[model samples]
Target: MCLQSDLVDADVDPAVIEATRSALHQQLEDAELIHQPDEAHLQTAKERSEQLNFAISSLRRQLDAQTRDVVAPRFDAIADTSPRVASLKASIDAITQLRESWARVHTINADIRSLKSERRRINKDIKEKSEQLKARQSLLGDLSTEFGRLLTSWNLPWVDTAVIDRDTFLPAVNGQPFESLQASGGGITTSVNLACSLTLLKFGLDHADVLVPSLLVIDSPRKAFGNNDSDRQRASEIYSRFRTLADAYGERLQLIIADNDPPPVTSDSFGKVEFDYDNPMVPGVSHPGPDHVSRLEETADE
Candidate 1:
């Protein structure tokens, strides 16, 4: 019966099934069963059960083989023993480092670009400043030449050459700074100061845009000179120079000199304000005495 069931479940050909049924009938007489079924269906039912069990066992073996093939590598990776996975991790780390390096390189390039731009701007500024300095130096040179000429005209023959200091614009007399001759006392200092003032005046006259006023006030140019021939000569020379400058520039320049004694020149040629002992420049106002105040009051009453 089991054989017949096997044949039927296997879906064998009808000819094979008939052959199996005959074989099963012969074998069934020797077979055993716990619950004896009706003879006609017994073999078929047993065959069906056997075939189903064999098919399930075969499918279980195939499923186990497939699971081993697909899941063993994943288990090895979980165990941290897969070479392929380690190589992939290394590749990922290398790529990440390369990306970080690229970012740094990009930042460096941007900084270089910015610094280059700044350098160009700074260079341009430096060039402009240099040009301005050169122009100022040229102007100072011209002024120094004019100052030297004026100093020579004022009878300072020692001041043959004059140069302006680049930084201070102060005169250098005969290739020496003006301060070098400061030990020569007030005469030399006063004369140099006057020469510098006239130099500025000349520069202002030449350059219309210059803000220098056309007026100069000197207090006692001959104050340092004593009652000696050399001092008297120097005083005369200074006054003569002043008169010459006034004549050359005419009303365009104004020079006011205040001294205890006047220059040895005609007062008619130049304006003069004289102050003597009787008509003192500073005349103090006097208050009236008591008798004078009483006389004024009596006059007011009359």
Candidate 2:
């Protein structure tokens, strides 16, 4: 019992100890069984443990080799290339700045090309407009010459030569505007108006582009002139000039005159329409007495 108690204290079940002792005693009686391990089996176990240790050592060596293979080249590459990387970064930065500068240059070149094209267009337009102005000025020169010739032919009292101003396109007698003749008298004004009208009629007939009709209407050339011998003589000369102009233009021009009395001309070149007290130009109006009728018609008919 004390031994069993001791066995229990040693954490060995007494029943299991007894069973193991009985099995060992039975094994000791067998001829093939020994109390200690066999040398051959111990040697085999030692060989197996040595093989396992060798395999573990080989695996550790392989792991170290793999680590070196994976990590050493990366560390070497990092140590060798720091300067090259910095140089490549600087080159990249330089290329970036050059590209930015080139882009700016390209933009400026494009703007310059656009402005040059616009300048060419403006020059073309200016040339075309200038040509048009030149043509208009030439036409005006021709008209001025024609107008001056008619004024000279009419024998203006004070005017030696007449010309149309290029800038104003108005008649200038002796390098002065025709309006200056208005200060002289109504006789001069009437003469200038008649000459200008005849000149304009001639110009209209000659130029296809002129808008004026080839017709003239004069109310009274001698209305401003008083009843005197000098006025009558001037009126006769004006009528003679009219006859000459009418004969020159012939059927191309139509001249109509409405006057109180006819000029002292015996030429059969012009037709006359006489309106008397008995036969008036307008109806529903009493004519003046037969004594007041114009005797210029009798002279014209004769």
Candidate 3:
């Protein structure tokens, strides 16, 4: 029922609309339509709340005394004697932490034992390998000495010194590579290769341990000779050396020689086979014309 002008003329802190709200409140207060709580009821509620608190305290005291007198001693005795009584959250957490630590220690101990066993096995293998290496080195040293002696005995005119490399086991002549002495054509190559083969054969024959063929085959000792008298003599000397080796080794060594022409051999201890255009090394081969008959006859006479 407030007039619009009255609403406009009202002075308020929050808003001008509060003028109606204040007037309605004053009318309600004057008419006693708004409630006013009784202090007597509030005082009765406070007294009841205090009585409930005291009653609860007395009950809690009785419970604590009963637990301390009866159940506490039994719990303590069980805790002291039986580990299973520790069912608390803190005890379980502590035990779990200790178990994790002990498991880690056990894992580390197992790894250490494995590593120690591996170390011992590795040490034993290394020791055996070292001994084998020493024995091999000694064998190579003897082989080198034997190779040097053979170069001199084989009529190697160009070579002053010869040796077998211990590491690679290749032949070296005059403190250099094998090719350095073979500039005299395939003859030198032939002799050096021949000497190496024979030396290994002799080594195998002498030592029952050095595994090599007791039998050897020579294609041609004088096949590369260029009409030089010294080359012929060298070839003859090679045959002589072969004879001596055969005599010395006896039944332990076998030598098979094949050649179109070889210098005169002083020894006749070996079997001989003659082959020409008529009879070749391989079967079912055609022969040459009659013009080669004289040459083949001359070779047979030689």
Candidate 4:
């Protein structure tokens, strides 16, 4: 029932208003997360790996120089003591290579340890965040249940996705978290997918709450897409699924997405409204509001 460019008034339904507020708050939360990416856990692992590499390189260089210094002084002595010199040279070379190789192996082992530590930390952080999300989602669920109870008293379909602790059920692979829907599938990639789906579902559930705002806006959800065509396509598909989820809410949530590039079009579900880049609301742009017009004219005469 809303137009694309319409400024939503403050008189919207409580559920719609709460949805809008949650969506906007969630967007801000996500933005803050991007600005402060949780690299602390990864940094320890990365630094350990780097230090190990540096130590290995430094030891190898030292060993190589020492070997050369040892061999260089024995060049003339080689004729008289050729067999000894040759044997010594072989021993030095073998030991140097072995030591260097061992150093590298040690570094690799250290790297594995660092990675395991990082993974543990990452999992802990993810678990904590998942718990927080569940906490918020539980509040939504209570609201949904209350709404359903009210509807039941009047006899109507619940229409809210009753999802709780769905994220905890997802299987994590490597550092990436994902859910295992199939016998052969489950990884970080899958966890991210599950997260996105849960986000979409949460968006809907929040919309059904009578205390939420009616607006759901995303600045650019696909900004993470790199130059890879397949990745871009995948991003588009994820976005499509998001829109589909929004539509499934069926008048419960009103979505508004703004981006520099046009989002992939679907059949009759979403529409675009382009604003002039010169507009003040679009950022780095000037606006000639009514109050500015006469002031500028008066200044010109002066």
What TM-score against the true fold does each predicted structure earn?
A: 0.61, 0.57, 0.58, 0.29
Candidate 3 C-alpha lDDT tens digits along 1-302: 56545544345456545787899889998666433354566677899889999999999999998889789899888778575554566688988999999999899999999999999999999999989888878887888888888778756667788888776687888776755646655876787788888889988888887899999999877887656788777777778878988888788888998877743785666767777765765555555657756676888899
* Whole-model lDDT, model 1: 0.77
Tell me each candidate's RMSD, in Å, in order.
15.9, 9.9, 15.5, 61.3
Give the alpha carbon lDDT tens digit for every residue of 30-128 in model 4.
988875655765787799999999999999999989988787767756666988878999999999999999999999999999999999999999999
Clashing pairs in 1: 1-43, 2-43, 2-47, 5-44, 6-47
* Clashing residue pair totals per candidate (backbone < 3 A): 5, 0, 0, 23
In terms of lDDT, model 2 sits at 0.79
Clashing pairs in 3: none
Q: Predict model 4's lDDT versus the native.
A: 0.59
The worst-scoring run of ten residues by lDDT in candidate 2 lies at 30-39
lDDT of 1 at 260: 86
Task: Using TM-score, rank the candidates from best to worst.
Answer: 1, 3, 2, 4
lDDT of 1 by residue, 1-73 (tens): 7555444455657887789999998677657453355554778878988999999999999998998878887
Q: Where is model 3 more than 4 Å wrong at Cα?
A: 1-95, 178-185, 226-229, 281-302
* CA lDDT scores, all candidates in order: 0.77, 0.79, 0.78, 0.59
User: For model 2, which pairs clash?
Assistant: none
Off by over 4 Å in 2: 1-132, 178-185, 226-230, 266-268, 282-302
